[model samples]
Target: MATQYANDIPFSASHDQQAFKLLELPPELLSLLESEHPPTLTITSSKATETTSGYALLCHGDKKYQMRQKNTSNPIMILAPSRTMPTESDDAETFISSPSVTTISKIEDTIELILQEAEVKAAPKNKWHEKFAKSRAEKKK
Candidate 1:
């Protein structure tokens, strides 16, 4: 049982093998899965060869949101925190965490930074400055 948070990355509940094969799981998710105390509920799974856009799993205490296209589905599902039910004032105007562009962008940026760190750690000899130096040398040549 993992502590699900708001604005967390959403995951698709796919059971198809093809979906997982095509879905690009962010490095962060990979890292989480590898962690010793990974959150069981936050784990993502897919079924189709490719992932679908505009979908995520909203998990609260016991509520699970299943938003998907019944016809053609993809595996690029996200694991996000559950949102409160919409109210009259919140209808189409209020800004809550759901399938939104801003939230997605933030998640992507965080993933990129995690990946950069991982790369740097994996390649101790090739620092960012050293890579820049190599590029400069090649350009000069």
Candidate 2:
């Protein structure tokens, strides 16, 4: 005979969905994250240009990858776990068994990363701090 566990909780999905986007990490990113010491990743976007609106890029140290926004028909949901506490309203000996989970949000699209080439890197004005500092120095002069 199999034993039944009494610690089962309920799960629910929220009708109201929050706005959220998911970034699909590349293989190189996965390896970097799995490494002993992971480097911080930065996401930077370009200003609107005459030819194009703009684009985003993800930076990993010296290397950079273009971030492309893509839409999908499939919905991706983000779930949140609900916490429980023992109730003593009737005092018949009731306790919270397990944590219940709920769906908190749904994602509309995903961001894909593409490795940026040397020529591609030259276009956008990056290293924002350097530009700001140079402007300040020029103003001071």
Candidate 3:
């Protein structure tokens, strides 16, 4: 009876086809799918080689996606979020909470202070000497 039940279920190539489909998807499409499903995602790439390089697989939501790059030079692709400046008419002030806004402002002020300190510390004390030495060396060459 158990053997009969096992035989009753027919194996289909759908899963294999699905796996193949997953491999061919781009990172953008994979990210969109991951955002929608919120599944565990894993990315793997082939080791540096002549022909096998630039091939990467993204595994997520029980599906695998394959991506091939035009060249093997760039092993990793990074997608950065786009930043937009808020206009006067923008309703971001209304949408964002006060606490969050305050936190963001504080962070920005801290970063600005750190950058100012870095710039002050990085200023060359012997700027004239360094520039004159470089120019003298170039004239000699």
Candidate 4:
């Protein structure tokens, strides 16, 4: 059976997703995860086998891991794994997992590509009129 690692923690404002940071994984997994194609995250959920409650999952590293979210006093350090557990276990648990390197890098690249395109499209049309106006006003003051 394929293993899984996942967490359902809610994302916070400080969750700064960036591309270069995504490279910090095992090189082969990193290469596999970050394709030039659009990346997609597959989330799954199901009812607990015994209880009426349910759990959520996010897949990374060819494994499916459970997930959860926590509210903390600090803002910047939000969305940490509730707990880190090795794959060997009997009962079910909840926690957050890091994004796979491929997922992270692909996302980062897509965002950068979009931003670059936007900058190119907007740069010439605006002609820096607003920027120049602000600069002239500042000089006068």
Candidate 5:
């Protein structure tokens, strides 16, 4: 029978400590959290686990929201108000104001309008066929 030694088991607590540290909210996010006051928002940096890729956690009361970066190299910031629910946690004192449906709809409409404007601005000024025709006419002259 082979004797198993304790040293054979690779047990280290450093990884957990590092993961906890990684989850610490950044100062910029904290400032935004204070300014926005979205009922409750807790931002945390996540490490890739077995099931999913690394993502940021945005907790609003008892409800949890995960924010996955579309591009690992460049991450975009998104701010959205969330409804708060009472929880039996130490941070239960945090309260959030819910926006009315009308307000949300107006915001959505404004965003759609802005996106339409941007699309219009980004469209090509001259069509390829038009340019080709103009060049052909010039060559004929």
Candidate 6:
């Protein structure tokens, strides 16, 4: 393999860090996304209860997939590149152009989707009697 090296160009990290999430889509999820008019997916977390620590899930339509964050030893960075135009020097004698890249965000972990059973569960029944419930009827005088 031939190796070529280019001159070092300056790259800077942004002052403000924007935390980014990396999601690894599974095959089932990929197919859903490729289909026409893909359903909207949402990330939701369950409230922490006495039995379980809060867990997150990726919801696609009525289907829900368990989302797990796996930490990585190396950090993944998202960068934006720009080519700066040549500007006049302090002495106004020369023009300097710098092509640079900026690190806009960093991701340390990735979210993995665990495929859950995609069963079409029955729609939930609404308790109409519970809402606007009637008070107890009065006894006969």
lDDT of 5 by residue, 37-124 (tens): 6465556655686886876656555444455322233322233344434446536556543432111111111100000111124456
* Superposed Cα RMSD, model 3: 25.7
| Model 2 spans > 4 angstroms off | 1-11, 15-18, 47-49, 83-100, 120-141
Alpha carbon deviation, residue 120, candidate 4 (Å): 53
State the weakest 10-residue window (summed lDDT) of model 4: 110-119
Model 1: per-residue lDDT, tens digit, 1-141? 566674465443324322122223455555765799865643233224355543344232343333332323322434434444455767566657454221221111111111111112334564889899999999999
- Candidate 5, residue 44: lDDT: 67
**Candidate 2 local lDDT, 3-25, one digit each (tens):** 56555667678888677878788
**TM per prediction:** 0.19, 0.58, 0.21, 0.26, 0.21, 0.63
Candidate number with greatest TM-score: 6
Positional deviation of residue 119's Cα in model 4 after best superposition, in angstroms: 47
Q: Which ten residues in a row have the lowest lDDT in candidate 5?
A: 106-115
Give the per-residue lDDT digits (tens) of candidate 4, residues 1-141. 544534343333323544331112334434656777523545577446565576665444345444544333433321333333335553445544543222111122111111011112324567589899999999999
Give lDDT for model 4. Answer: 0.41
Q: Per-residue alpha-carbon lDDT of model 6 for 53-93, expressed as tens digits?
A: 97887887777888988999999999999655554544444
| Candidate 2 Cα deviation (angstroms), residue 71 | 1.5
C-alpha RMSD of each candidate structure in angstroms: 21.2, 13.0, 25.7, 22.2, 21.1, 10.0
Prediction 6 global C-alpha lDDT:
0.78
Candidate 6, residue 44: how far the Cα is off, in Å: 3.7
The per-prediction tally of clashing pairs is: 17, 0, 4, 17, 1, 0
Model 5 misplacement above 4 A: 1-38, 70-141
